[model samples]
Target: MEHFSQTLARAAERKGGEQNLFNLVSAPLPEQQLLAQTDDRCLAIMTKVVFQSGFSWRVIEQKWQGFEDAFWQFDPHKLVLLDDSHIERLMNDTRIVRNGQKIKTVPLNAQFVLDTANDHGSFARFIAQWPVDDITGLWLHLKQHGARLGGNSASFVLRRMGKDTFVLSRDVTAHLIAQGVIDKPVTSKTALKQVQHAFNTWQQQVALPMTQLSQIIGLSVGSNERQV
Candidate 1:
């Protein structure tokens, strides 16, 4: 298992392409990265993004201080203490989204976080149950629980706190295709299966072509480790 983990880490050092460092989809603005975060700071990030999603990130970025002040830094225990009077005050605060429902959802979501922490003792203990640790899973979970998504125009936010590295965007996949690292474009839901097959083929075919590929060559890309 250590070998497997080491091999996967080494294979991941190769970036998608030279231009990918600036690619829009893979390299998003602050909101996505901050919200997708999974550390102890995550509760505050998730709280801010829930309302921040209603407006463009540009707007949120400009007024984030107002939000910080408004929410008292998103302390879970303090937020749960908010009563009807607090809601009235928040509804008029221009610093936040000022939408009643989204405002209400904040304290409730914080309370949910508190409840989960109470039951599980910590957030890390909570996420360990599921095996699918993809970036999409994180963002989708947030969206399902009442956090907002930026409309189709601004940006596509996936969970990318960068703790894991396999959440390659559409552009990243295209670059891999150009490099022959992956097979042809897969536009359908079955794309994942095709990738799996192509990768297996890569593993079987790599060693026959060169002696240097025999568990050798520094940070090698066209080797068995690149297969999957």
Candidate 2:
């Protein structure tokens, strides 16, 4: 496999320059700040990622204010307490997407946030305590424990919330394949381990966050520009 520095250099050339490449990729928040986030903020991100799955992100972005209002700013305590009437109300509400199944996930995810908090002092703390080197492990945890937080949705949630993690998007997966990190899409436990090890190595060697490394690899493979 090529050294990660070679991969990043290739990406920088394609993106115009290193600065340009850096400008496109997002930086993660400090550990303290990440841990300081309230349960509401975490739940809001989870809800947004959940709703964005299999739907147009533009539509979700346009209706985000409505979502905030409908979910009472995603206050986990209040959301967990909502009854069937609340779900029905949101299902009929025009301001949001009005998808019944997605709407139902909101309260379930809210309770997940609260339940995690109840066990770990706070949801933010639990996530913040997660080691970035084993980010896929965290993703697995989300899939197992959180509602509607499977696959890339879990990664997107962490990325949106300023967590220092990598996403296995199609583009990124392509680059990983090209770099001989994996033979196919990351799915099986062994494949995910290979991907994680590649990222962890790159991170340690370059002193860059997994988020930046992931984006750089994606760019190297000509992936569409996105806010990583």
TM for every model, in the order presented, reads: 0.50, 0.94
lDDT of each candidate versus the true structure: 0.47, 0.88
lDDT of 2 by residue, 100-200 (tens): 98888887898888889999999999999998988999999999888889879889999988899998878888888987889988778799899999888
Candidate 2 TM-score over all chains jointly: 0.94
Query: Candidate 2 lDDT (Cα, whole model)?
Result: 0.88
The number of the candidate with the highest lDDT is 2
Positional deviation of 201 in candidate 2, in angstroms? 1.1
Give the alpha carbon lDDT tens digit for every residue of 173-209 in model 1: 5534754555755444355444434333433454211
